[model samples]
Target: MTNNTPRVALVTGGSGGIGRTVVERLARDGMAVGVHYAGNKARAEETVAAVQALGGRAVAVSGDVADEHAMSDAFDTVEREFGGLDVVVNTAGIMLLSPIATLDLDDLDRMHRTNIRGTFVVSQQAARRVRRGGAIINFSTSVTRLQFPAYGAYAASKGAVEAMTLILARELRGKDITVNAVAPGPTATELFLDGKDQAAIDTLAKAAPLERLGTPEDVAESVAFLAGPARWVNGQVLYTNGGVA
Candidate 1:
């Protein structure tokens, strides 16, 4: 028998960018949401309020994705506030771009700490706490396949996400949970636009066969599918790029 209760979701880094759009899309799909943010409490609250303004249920929860205790508490808050978790979208990550040769070790370490370790930590909690028939969607980047020059460290971190995501799907064989990763190409978000001049932006916009940069809404559509339906699409790294790779 199908359950009548509304599914709930916890989106890490949901305060901004793709994460924010993901939260909005999930809420529109009739799920209560926990918007998790690392540092910006106010920003997360804004996302929650926006959802509420649209007659959706949402709550802002804060935590550093890399901190086990913190993430555990965030999950606890979501389960407690929303009744239970039906989906987890680990969108919390950092990107520091530089050619491999001159890349700062500290930057690499910081990026990995959030992008790799953070994904693992969040996925672990989702595995333990998310109810059966739920979904776990992790974020990846097309740069792993695109082989962009300065994205070595960033792509390495995402490559790890892809590997663990596939293994985690198999590991949860009997749980009725689907684990997948969404790898998006360049999207038109504030975070992606930051520091990029118009020329560079234009160049990337034309890189895809679509001849334009992707919008957050474009990426969120794929996430909404993985979170709610598309049950047969499991253990895969879905390249949500518009033919960029």
Candidate 2:
């Protein structure tokens, strides 16, 4: 956090919809970025290329977010490449929806492995490695509050994330590191749009006071604030849902 040296950020799931925007936003904030992808090497590379196109420094690192060793290596790569780590953003997640009465336990387990365990793994590394003045941002969802049917499993996982974010922030006290979660509502991303009918999307969009789906850029702005100047905003969930409770 010195004056001359630039900050470094590693964004997990950086190849996807919101993750890609987070990468670009952090890079635009003058932080060298590590774009982490799970399986999409080409998309990850394209993100890196886009960052480079903007004349920003970036590298692509791949790993399963739930794998401890892979994430450790990823942290190492980002730190080694950029000289140090200042921000870690966990954006890699999966959502499979079903009513709790008939939900597949297999689906629940799979989603938990990625959303819950994945946040923990990445967070453990960030807690251990991120420099002072750093921030760790995890993704949650406003559905935890809205309690929409069929999102029980997803909400449960993100509820765990909100809990972890507060606990991690308290644990990092005096370290000057902030831990928080960004819970976005009805963002217009492939993940949210996939398999959703137009009526369903419109209903959710109008549920917010903004009366429209949130753009990835809208969420990225919240992230950029947390990563840069929101020093006092710790151990909290900032709902980037356009006033949707």
lDDT of each: 0.94, 0.94
Q: Which ten residues in a row have the lowest lDDT in candidate 2?
A: 187-196
What TM-scores do the predictions have? 0.98, 0.98
Tens-digit lDDT string for candidate 2 (50-98): 9999999999999999999999999999989999999999999999899
List CA RMSD, all candidates.
1.0, 0.8
lDDT per residue (tens digit) for residues 27-90 in model 1: 9999999999999999999999999999999999988898999999999999999899999999
Query: Backbone collision count in every prediction?
Result: 0, 0
Which 10-residue window of candidate 1 scores lowest in summed lDDT?
A: 1-10
Off by over 4 Å in 1: none
TM-score of 2: 0.98
lDDT score of residue 63 within candidate 2: 92
